[model samples]
Target chain A: MGGSLLEQLPLFLSYSNVSFLAQAFGVTVALSIVGCVVGYTVGALLAFIRNRHVVDVLPARFLSVGFSETFRRVPFLVKLMVVFFAFEVVGMRVSMFTVTATTVALAAAAFSAEIMRAGLEALPESQWDAAESMNMGGVMSLRLWALPQSWKVILSPALSFTVGLIKSTSIASQISVFELTYAAKVLNERGFSPVLSFGSLLVLYFLICYPLNLYARRLERQLERPRGWKSGAPLLAESEAA
Target chain B: MHYLEIDRFTASYDGKEQVLVDVSIQIAKGEIISLIGPSGSGKSSLLRGLMGLLVPQSGEVMLDGEKVDYTNRKSVKALRERLAIVFQQYNLFQNMDALRNVTVAPVKIRKRNAREVEEEATALLRKVGLGDKLHAYPDELSGGQQQRVAIARALALKPDILLLDEVTSALDPELVSEVLDAIRILAAEGMTMLMVSHEMALVREISTRVVMMDRGRVIEEGSADRIFDNPRTRRCQAFVGKILSH
Candidate 1:
């Protein structure tokens, strides 16, 4: 049997172990945040394609609906394998990290598209009518009037979804990506007790995610303030110069 | 060419259900033409169709001798730039204050100087009696005040023609006259206007011409005296009798 946790703690906290875990921790953070940014951009574009007032092309609408509907229904792990083998079958060698990150982005894009669609729908139909009648383009209406009004409806859910994606990045371990969960498993297999190995992971993940949870809650509170509490129509000025 | 012309126009919300069936009317510049009829008579649909809000299935809407092709973006944009409509719901941008709602299109879409637009918007708001409520959000204002903001917003565009789709219909009875007073100011100034209104008194007092519609077609139209006192069609007379009796 291994020595008591107190005695084993020093070896576990060695410089090499610490560095390896640090690298793994960095990977987890990068995967989630980068995935979210890429996911959101593509997702918003997908939403625009799906919007009748914006795209108005049936074929483009079909493609957008198909992408969101298909990706949203697939299990994340299955998506990871599909992506992994997709690269392999294409004869393109890619890193396991690339494979995992791509899967997270795929899942995030689908969910983010749906979330954004809901946000856009939250406004009254007349909002679009007013903008369209004013000769404001569909994209312009979204940026100036529609998106700003929908931020409160979108923010809480979007942040929460990002947090869920962060936790879900644990599944990246299945592909042998060097993220937190994989690091814990390696440490445990190397004779550290499961409690010490997994427990430390528990703390580290909490360290990374709790502040974000707090931040999401804070943002939700800020946005939950009554409508018209905003002092200005700032969105009107944002992209007009472009 | 007439300042605005809708000739044998047929339109639908969905392709199958014709809401504006063979609807045709014309407005000369500076004329206050009121559309009056029972609910679902498609009076409002004519204005919406002319804006390209409805699918124009047949006929034509010509402005200043240019035919409006609703399927063409530039044509629709040009049509909208020349004509602006205020809804009965007062579809002011809920995210904006009265002043911003009034100024957004002129400054952003029209690309006018922001300062000049604001100055004009402020004056327009004052004209509609919304000067005191310029900073107020739509949710913060009463129905009459909000509709006034919508009117000011529409006027800020400096359209060749202003369309009011039942502006007073959504108001509380006490709130109705404030909106009417604002429209009366426009009437006095000889602004080109097309309005769908149930306030027969306002329509009678301000409209040079009145068009009565029923089941997606214009049943009769003439000077207010002709339409109100002596409607030529049974549909028009029945509609006027039912509306006025209330």
Candidate 2:
């Protein structure tokens, strides 16, 4: 006698709150894009310090170590609360957009630094020796080769982290950012069935995250195979004869 | 007067135990010298010191009879352009194709046109017997092939002297001959060379002079025949005997 979950989807689609849902989608997309861009810029700077051992200054090293550890250890919700509360205390009446972006970016940067450090450490020492032998200076060597190679190594992990960051952005709703989860919560409280509301939110998160995960995996597969493999073996033999 | 001279050179990696101590050597304009020693006996350290990768604690490295100013960047770059090293590990940039790897420093550091550098790199690769493999990455090549490409890369700059650091040590037995053949051709062309290696047969055949090192010191130096057939120092004789046995 009860309609199936699939039948309920059409009813949900025709719900009067469809415009609100569309607005929530827009906010979610904007928050993720802005958060990732700002996060990557700040993270890259932090990664440089971690890579170059520039954190040699005791205070600077302490700050970096403390910032990374504190963010990593605390829950994302806690970070959002702290950031929002701290800004409120300072009497800076910032918009929810600014607060959400800043909180997510700061949290994302700590994780990015760790990912980059692992990538850097995986590089062979011989790369440095080769660069030095060619008389390449420190900055030029990093710019020309080291950074590019490190990016290749970290690509998959970085992409996965980005997906995690997208899901975590849901927590920003707790601070009244009105992102996807916030809209779903408001709708569910208004007599929409809890199962349908929560289930759709779960489906939305999967739809957003799945394609990116597949793309990252595809790239990893492509990278694992040497580029232009068809001519590789014979070319090796020919070079030996030359 | 020698073209390059290292006098009373003393160096160590952590400044505690010495790796190269009170070592002196002279390289002539167009002669091949081989340095043979047991592992960890400072042969590679001496070469690295000459390249300014490791600065000696108390000594002088004179190039063309003038003290080399390692502190000066321009001077160091100039010196490096005239000197090229082939490492045991080949050390080719794995990301680059063979031709690009060979041409990179020449084009970037020497301000040469990339197209012109590519032509030179092609010729050098051909000389090392790798003409067809220009576009292959280092990971795709065999150890011998990679080492030969390394030789080509070194030659691309037209260096005044070539330093070979156990170039064939990392190769399989079957692959060693190919790399050695490339080195033999380089020797025939009268390239001034300083080689640190364990291949006694190759050293005896190609080296004009052999320097036998032991415990951070040159225990003996003379013609390769004398060093191999009839070493004078007890240490030299024993070292040679052990290598010959293997």
Candidate 3:
């Protein structure tokens, strides 16, 4: 049996153990970022494909809708297991990290697609009508008006979702991917105190997520205030605020 | 050929309920024709359908000898290039200021020189009496001012015919005159316009012709005086009598 927690402190802080934990930390970060980046790109595509204003193909719309609805309803661990077993059934040999990362991206795509669709749909019909009357194509309409107007709606929630996604990456450890939670478990089994190992995860996760959440807030504030608008000024009527 | 010709045009908001049914009209160059009808009488739907916003299920529109096939990309493109519309709600891009709202379509869609478009847009805003409010956003302006900016935006496109859909109806009672004054400025220049208006006095003053609609059909049409003072159809007479008494 390992001695009291204080006695294990030296061993836990040993250079080799620190390096092992460092590698686990790196895996967690890489998994979250790569998965989320892929998720956002594909999710935005899914949202547009399903959008009636942009696409008219019935099958394409149905497929995206089905994918989003199916994946969003599934539990995260269940999704990881499904991906893992599906790869096994296909006779593909892949790393546990790859399996979990793919699950993160798939989950992200489904969730973010709904976020994007909500933002795009919230725009008034008049905005689209005005664009259509001018004969602006879908791309041109999005570029000129819809995107500029909807970015605040799309981006704030998306970035906040990213922070939540980073937390969800801890679940990857269950697949033996050596992410934060797995790193903590391995350390605890190797005679480090549970407090020392698990406590480190709480700190590291906070470190990874706090700045991202702050950045999201800052970006939201920037988008909310259009150029030439004075902060805290009352809306004027036919009078020069200048 | 007439400057604009719409024949037997029929359309529905949904595929089921026809908003405009067998509507027909003709306009020569430099004529201002007003569509005056009861609410939900398809005045706005006619303008929207003509622009291919509502998708005409069955109709033929010929503009300057080129038939607009709304299903065909090139035909719709050619149609839009020659026509512009000002919505009743003054649907300015909320992200843009008044000047940018006026200049965006010409510079972006038409690929006009930006500098030239800016100058023309400035002049157009000035023509509509919003010279001082060029930098203001839509929300920053009064309802009357926003409508004028919308007018400037449509004018900057230099459409062969402008369709104004109740341009001043959304304004407050006091604000209505300012927007109407701007329309009078356009009328004085002899701009070809198809307008839907609740302002009977202005319609009578500027319309070369007036068409009355009820239940999605053009029931009566003639000079503003003939339609307003001496309508032929009993329904039109009752409608005009109700409007005139107000």
Q: Over all chains combined, what TM-score does candidate 3 have?
A: 0.93
Mind giving the per-residue lDDT tens digits that candidate 1 earns over A185-242?
A: 9999999988888998999899888888898888778766335423234533543444
**Residues B1-246, model 3: lDDT tens digits:** 699999999999877899999999999999999999899999999999888888678978999987899888788888888889999999988878898888778767877766677789888989889888888877789989999999998899899999999998898999999889988988999999999999999999999999999888998989999998889999889989999999
DockQ of candidate 1 (2 decimals)? 0.45
Name the best candidate (by DockQ).
1
lDDT of 2 by residue, B40-98 (tens): 88899887777777656887788887787776767777778778888889887766788
How do all the candidates rank in terms of TM-score, highest first? Answer: 1, 3, 2
Q: Give each model's whole-structure lDDT.
A: 0.87, 0.81, 0.87
lDDT of 2 by residue, A1-242 (tens): 14666776676777567778778878887888888888877776666666543233566555666777778788888888887888899999999888888888887788877777677777777667767777876566666566666666777998999899999889888778898899899877865677877777888788889998998998787766334322234434434454
Residue A239 Cα positional deviation in candidate 2, in Å, after optimal superposition:
25
Once superposed on the true structure, which residue ranges of model 1 sit more than 4 Å away at CA? A225-242
Which digits, one per residue and each the tens of the lDDT, describe model 3 over residues A127-177?
Answer: 788877887777777777777778888888888888888888888777778
Fraction of native contacts, model 1: 0.49
DockQ of 3: 0.34
Those runs of model 3 whose alpha carbons end farther than 4 Å from true positions after fitting are A89-91, A225-242
Error of 2 at B204 (Å): 1.5
Chain B superposition TM-score per model: 0.98, 0.97, 0.98
Q: After superposition, how far is residue A35 of candidate 3 from its true place, in Å?
A: 0.8
Give one digit per residue, the lDDT tens place, for model 1 in B1-246: 588889999999988899988888889998999998889999888888888899889998889988889999899998998899999899877777888888888878988876678788889988888778878888889999999999998988988999999998888999999999999999999899999998899999999899988899988889998998898888888887877788
DockQ of 2: 0.25
The lowest-lDDT stretch of 10 consecutive residues in candidate 3 chain A is A230-239
